[model samples]
Target: MYTFIISIILLVAGYFTYGKYIEKMFGVKEERATPAYVNQDGVDYLPMSSNKNSLIQLLNIAGVGPIFGPIMGALYGPVAFIWIVLGCIFAGAVHDYLTGMISIRNRGAHLPELAGKFLGKVMKHVVNAFAILLLILVGTVFVTSPASLLHNLMNGKVSLLIITLFIFGYYILATLLPIDKIIGRFYPIFGALLLVASLGVGGMLIIQQVPIPELTLANLHPDQMPIFPLLFLTITCGALSGFHATQTPIISRTTQTEKQGRKIFYGMMIAEGIIAMVWAAAAMSLFQGANGLNELLATGGTGLVVSEVAKVTLGAVVGTLAVLGVIVLPITSGDTAFRSARMIIADYIKLPQFSMKKRLLIAVPLFVISIALTQIDFNILWRYFSWANQATAAIALFVGAMYLFIARKNYWVALIPGAFILYTTTVYILNAEIGFRQSLNVSYVAGAVISVVLVILFFKAAQKSRAAELSLEVDISDYRNIAS
Candidate 1:
């Protein structure tokens, strides 16, 4: 409990501190030469309404990854907290901020479009492929985890079919509703419920005398455990995430002020980190060892984990309410995932050029795939999804680094976070031994390979940008002479 509170405080404090630095360094409030970048007609580049942009940005970015990723990582014990805090700041937050700003500058272009503009067609296609795959994996995880939790809550009496119907209904509402209306109404309600549930669960745990696990850096079954998978889980959320890069442009297009990007992007990531900490603390407080934790999860699944924690803290009824809260939170997140997938596929097919019926046709298969995948074990899907997510993050960091160099040659400060992410993810890959000594389970290895290739492409783009700048300067001088 102490650790959770401290983690929240630290994350909030870090947001204000580091966020202010980004605000000052970037000067997002400065007037642009033209408002073309900020304002748009409708489909691709709609102007933001107001400060609510920040809230919308928060709602879009905060999701199940932060919650389940951290809880699952906590299997290694409390030390996992360190990775969550540091990685959120250095990797996740930085990638989000840069991606948002870049998107805003590029006339609300999505990441793939931006990649095509800056990195070239080949790279753009590659990024799009990676992004689509990452979203599928994320959607799969989101569906499976919550469904598993729902199953546990109903004591496995709830058939997968019923859960699927409920999720599809939620996704339909998420799609049909306006993004702003949904967020404006539900975010506060859901957030408040979560706060109450968290507090209630914590309070009940104290009253019920649930056994808190000992804090230790000691390894559990060191010989049996593979080093790679452990490291992969430890650094899961922090390093390179594919899903974040895709969402960055979505929020960027909705931002009112470029200045708000730092607060909305980094602040949300920090909030997610804190949420992860809370769940991790909850898990730690409720279970003793890995085996015990496994048994609890097997019995109640992740849903039971929350229910039992709440029951220990609040009482049976309130605990069940808390479990319900837990289920709703992820379901909300999954809805967004579904929405994002639809948007991506819509863009992929250029369905705006087609009728609305055609767009729905493209969207149906994607939703069906998500629903089918949801029936499986969420934890397994999350493991693979996290790896692909890191790969995208690495590419994004490379892109951000290039943007900084192109926009302001002296702005090396912007690269600090990127450098840290590269270093940590690299270390995580090199030191860890993944399952069967393969790279598939190791995000660092995957991220490193992708990062190296992107870095090469970035430098090539920078060189061409310099040449174009020089040519424009020469043409301007000639035009000035003609005017004189």
Candidate 2:
């Protein structure tokens, strides 16, 4: 009981401290100019629709990651929550908010294009490549995780091929359908199903008088005492995630008011954090440390932890419903992934004569590749994906630093986040023990060194820009005085 209370307190406090701070900083001001690009598209660029509530956005953005990451974090005991909450505040929310706002201000341009404007054409392509690689890694992991869960629920009766086809077909439908119509109509139905499934499992656990084990700091697993994976997963949005960069912009493009961006983005992310906490609690309550680890390994992914919890909490019937709900969330994520990837490709490669066709062409192959990769081990894939995802986010921090230097004449705010992410990610890379992990670590080390170099270059560029502006102002003032 005390643990649950503490978790809730931490979540609420973090939300108020970091989430609301960002909100207050970017809050609506009557005199502030409406971003020009946002004004141009009244149809798509309007503030969030009145019909759209915060819950739908929450469900849309929260995927299997939130469920699984926390379970993995729980392997390290209660200490994991500290990193999750703090990381979300300083790293995750800031990235989501700034990237979303920038995209909105730049006429729904995604992260890569914004990077180009701030970082230059060469760095722009570098960032875009990084972003795309992150997306592919994220998309592939998401695809495999849920498919594995679905396969288990079907008692392994469903062939991987059929699962891939079903997922691919769903993406195609989501893509062909208009964005507003799909999100507005289908998402609410899916969200409600998820709520019912989660609650149903909870209700059954209560009715069945299932035993809740007494948790203690001493009882925590000693072998898995490492904090870095918890740090890695915590920032990944079961606790917090860089993937929110893609999600925030999608929500931003549809938001009805500039103010609502904070509400939607932060609100949804917090809700996800809460969901992750609940799953972590559920895992602890349902299984012992070794059992939980074995279950995750036996089922072939972390998502199985949620399904297994539901099966134990409820009977098979309701458990099946829980599995289906789990599947839907990732499907929504995949839909978003496909759309975002298409948007990225469209922005970078002009196929003016064949725009829609070009986007579909890019999306289909990417989806196919992702589905093929789904056959691999999900745990290993997730670890790689999380690291790659953070690396891209590190680059985004550099871009944000440049923005701050240009607009505020102070780069400390963005620089601090960038530096922290770089350090944490480097620690993660160095500690990782995969095959060729050392080589990968060296690459990231090199990347971090380059990021620091770029930070210096950006400051120089900002100084030149400021100098030119000052010169123009002085010449104009002198001419006016002479004429007078």
Candidate 3:
């Protein structure tokens, strides 16, 4: 209980302290007009109030990942608390802010464009494909998840196929239309649903006065998954996801000024961290402890645990609403994934986005591909999706580190986290059941060696971007001057 409460308090404090410092270090200027103001295209790049932007940013990044990931992570005991609090403050929020601000600084450049600018041309193409695949996977996974959940809620009276088509129809419409029309409008309503669901369970825990597991270092994973890499991987979206960086460019374009960057980007991520912490505690508390939670998870998986938990914790009707509210997490995030897929394809090919036909030209094919993907088993697809999500973060972290290095700021802020994520992804890839099937000790040593090499690569890229920054001629000296 102390851990849970203190973690939330620390996140708020993190905002004014580290969040403010990072904002200033990045040199967010009130005087500078954002891309939204500079290139108001009503379609994707339109300005909005900071309040709405904040909510959109929250919902965009807050998928079932936080809710689901932390619930699973809670099985690791209260160590999840440490990861959520420290990871959000130092790693996740910083990753999102830097990437988002970098997008804003570069006239709403997407993640691939940002990587290309800092990491070099070769990486540009690599990350471009990487980001698109991850987004597609996200869109696909997001679609199937909510549809299945909703179908189960209705006792399969409503076919998953119909729910899926209806949802994908929304994604197609949302993708083709102007930003302000569908997404910018109803996303907040969905956002409210997610919040109420989170707070509903959260408030119940408090009212019931359930005893959250005390903070401990014990490795409670039933498989005896290592506390370091597996816990980090299992809890990717909640603590820090490269996935959020993809979503960053969306809000980067809509933001009114650079001054709002910290609030929307950094602050929103902190909000997710709080949401994650609460869910983690509630899952643990409601299960009578992490062990019971893990046993249920082994038998039933995450979705079943979710429905059972919501119905048990919040009552029947409200619980139905809460569970559907949980469904809102994926549906909202999935469409944005498709929306981002369209935007990314347009940006990559340099296609004009003003016309509905042009947007459809890109979006129709993407949605078809996503619908095709729905045929695959969810567990199989998610294993790859999970890796893809963190791998994206690994790249974005490097991009941010490279940007900071070019700016002559403390690149350590991003570099360390990037290196750590790189190690986790590497370790998991080599050692997981679906992976290369290496022994644990072998993978551990390999991950550590690779992690060090990643750090070395960071230094090399920093130096590389130093000369490249001058040649590219994008102004970094304002931030550079601030760094001094």
Candidate 4:
């Protein structure tokens, strides 16, 4: 219990302290006009108040990952607390703030464009495909999860196919309409429900004095899954998720000022960390122990655990509301995933998005692909998504580090976390069924080798980027002097 409370406090404090340092390092320009104002197209690039932007940003990134992932992470015992706090503070929030602010500085470019600019031209195409694939997977998973949950809630009275089609239709409307029309308007209401759900469950657990397990380094899993890479991958959203990078640009284009980046990006991630911490604590305290949690998980999975916990803690009336809140997380994220895909494709093709016809040109095919993906098994899609998600995160962090390096700021803030997650991403695929399927020792050694090589290559690119940036600055200064 003390560990859990301390972890939450640390996360909040980290935002005020470390988060402030990050803001300072990035050098926020309050006077600088944002993309929303400069490029007011009444579509994606329209300014919104900080409060609205923060709410949208929170819901946009707060997929079921925070709830489901932490519930699963509870099987590993209180050690999950450590990852949620540290990973969120250092890697997750930093990745988000940098990505959002950098996008604003670059006319609201998406991750692929930013990746290409910072990482390399080749990475632009690679990361483009990588990000679009991740978004589609996210969209498809979110749609299926919510539709299934809603079907179960209705006791299978409603056809799953109908619920799914209904959701896909909503996604189309949300993606096709202006940002403020569907997403910007509905997200605040959804954000309120999300808060009520998490806070209600977390508050009750504390009020009831549920005995949350204290932190320990011991391997507490019933299956004794190694905590090294698996735990990191298992808990991404509340800790650090590359998916947030894609979502941040959505708000980045809508932000009225650079100052809000800290709140909308960094602060909301802390909010998610709090949400994650609460769920992890609740899952740990409610179940008999790690063994009990594992048994239930193996039998019924995350949805069952969520339903049981909500009903037990919050009662049937409010628990139902909480479940609705959980449903909201995925639906909100899914729409934006399709929306981001549309924007990314439009940007890639250099198509003007002032008209609906141009937007549909990209959005139509994305929805078609997402619809096709629904036929694939959810678990299989998740397995591939898990690695790709973290890989996307690693790349985003490297991009952040590169941006800071070129700007002559403290690049280590992003570089260290980027390196750690890169190692995790590397080791997981090498050992997982999806990738090379190597032995643990082979994975460890090979992952290290691969990470080292990549870091060296990153530095090479950074050096070239930094030199070019410096030359540009000098040229600007010289041109200014001549004009004067």
The numbered model that scores best in TM-score is 4
lDDT of 1 by residue, 142-260 (tens): 66666767877788798977886777776766654555556546766676666577556555555665554433546432335554435444445432355777776766656656556
Better candidate number, 1 or 3, judged by TM-score: 3
Cα-based lDDT for every prediction:
0.61, 0.63, 0.84, 0.90
lDDT of 4 by residue, 1-484 (tens): 8998899899999999999999998998776777787667999999888999999999999989899899988888888998999999999999999999989888798999998888878999999999999999999999999998898778899999999999999999999999999999999999999999999998898888889998765544435568888999999999999999999999988998788889999999999999999999989989799778888888877888888888989999999999999999999999999999889988998998899998888989998998999999988988888888999999999989998898888999999999999999999999998999999899999999999999999999899888877321111111121110
Give a tens-digit lDDT track for model 3, residues 420-439: 88998999988988898999
TM-score-superior candidate, 2 or 3: 3
Clashing pairs in 1: 204-312, 204-313, 204-314, 205-313, 228-433, 240-390, 241-389, 242-389
Quote model 1's TM-score: 0.80
Better of 2 and 3 by lDDT: 3
| Candidate 3: residue 59 lDDT (0-100) | 87
Query: Which residue segments of model 4 deviate by more than 4 Å?
Result: 217-223, 470-484
Q: 238 in model 4: Cα distance from truth in Å?
A: 0.9
Over 4 Å off in model 1, which ranges? 1-5, 30-55, 156-158, 181-184, 199-229, 232-240, 353-355, 372-379, 409-436, 439-484
Candidate 2 residues lying further than 4 Å off, grouped into runs, are 27-56, 196-224, 233-235, 290-292, 351-356, 409-414, 431-484
> In candidate 2, what are the lDDT values of residues 1-484, reduced to their tens digit?
4565466577767677777776665444322222322332432234445246465566656777777777776666665555556665666666766676666556566778777777667877986777777676667766766777788777889897688678777777665444666765688778877777766664555566554333466754346455543356443675546666765666655655456566666656666666666666666566766466666746655666777787787677878888788787777777777667666776688533134565567777777777677777766777777777676666666666666555653456556766666656765666567523555457567647855776677678767655554221001111121110
CA displacement after TM-score superposition, residue 476 of candidate 1 (Å): 21
